[model samples]
Target: MAKNPDIKAIITTDKDLVINSGVPVFLSKNLEHLQVLCESLERILDASSHEINDETVIIVAR
Candidate 1:
């Protein structure tokens, strides 16, 4: 019933593919870049980031 706290963004180093969801997706050059992007995005979007793997991270408010 609520999507406010749901996925707000996505960060991935993989440039080959991405989902078609409405969430904003950020592409990074490498793992380190991904982490740095995640940190900046987390603060900017006021959400927490979760690493789905070494190449991917999902951002959510809760």
Candidate 2:
């Protein structure tokens, strides 16, 4: 998979704690560029999001 130059950051969390974060970069033409960006973001989140354990509980504050 290609990286995305425009993506600043990808954040992931579990049990109110950050589990992972990443930034991706890649070079591509117009349409491919956008696709890469979107794909990168998806990969970032997918790579970061993890299954929780019985002792873990995710919490968020608005």
Candidate 3:
């Protein structure tokens, strides 16, 4: 997916789902531009809460 210009982001999780592995794992890719993507996502989550509304939806795709 990284090879595709149209693919902006990609999310993945471990089999146990005990942790958000993507947050740290992707940082290791060492691409400055891609590193920002992970940082941005972490910021968004840190700035928001789990109190979602009825109209809100979250999807985690492998």
Candidate 4:
């Protein structure tokens, strides 16, 4: 059986902009760090990463 894709976590440089939620949020030092974190977590979390904007990325399980 297949499972529905669901948002697993969110990564952002500006933690203040993202609201508190059930999803885990990771705050990075800057854009570079955010990208790196997103890539690493995408693999570690076994999920795909998506760019919400310049400063935000979200991870979703496939």
| Candidate 4: pairs in clash | none
- Kindly give the stretch of ten consecutive residues in candidate 3 with the minimal lDDT sum: 48-57
Candidate 2 structure quality by residue, lDDT tens digits, 1-62: 96543434322222243434343233233444444454565555443222134322212111
Q: In terms of lDDT, which candidate is stronger, 3 or 4?
A: 4
**Candidate 1 residue-wise lDDT at 56:** 93
lDDT winner between 2 and 4, please give it. 4
lDDT of each: 0.86, 0.36, 0.34, 0.90
Rank all candidate structures by their lDDT, best first, as comma-separated numbers: 4, 1, 2, 3
TM-score of each: 0.82, 0.26, 0.26, 0.85
Model 1 over residues 1-62: C-alpha lDDT tens digits?
85555888889988775767798888899888998999998998888998898899999985
Assess candidate 1 and give its TM-score to the true structure: 0.82
Winning candidate number (lDDT): 4
Of 1 and 4, the candidate ranking higher by TM-score: 4
lDDT of 4 by residue, 1-62 (tens): 97866999999999696777889899999999998999999999899998998999999997
Q: For residues 1-62, what per-residue lDDT tens digits would candidate 3 score against the true structure?
A: 37512222343322232244343333223345444554575466443212122222122222
Error of 4 at 11 (Å): 0.3
Global Cα RMSD, each model: 2.4, 15.1, 12.6, 2.6
Question: Which ranges of candidate 2 are over 4 A from the true structure?
Answer: 1-29, 47-62
Candidate 3 residue pairs in backbone clash: none
Lowest summed lDDT window (length 10), candidate 1 = 1-10
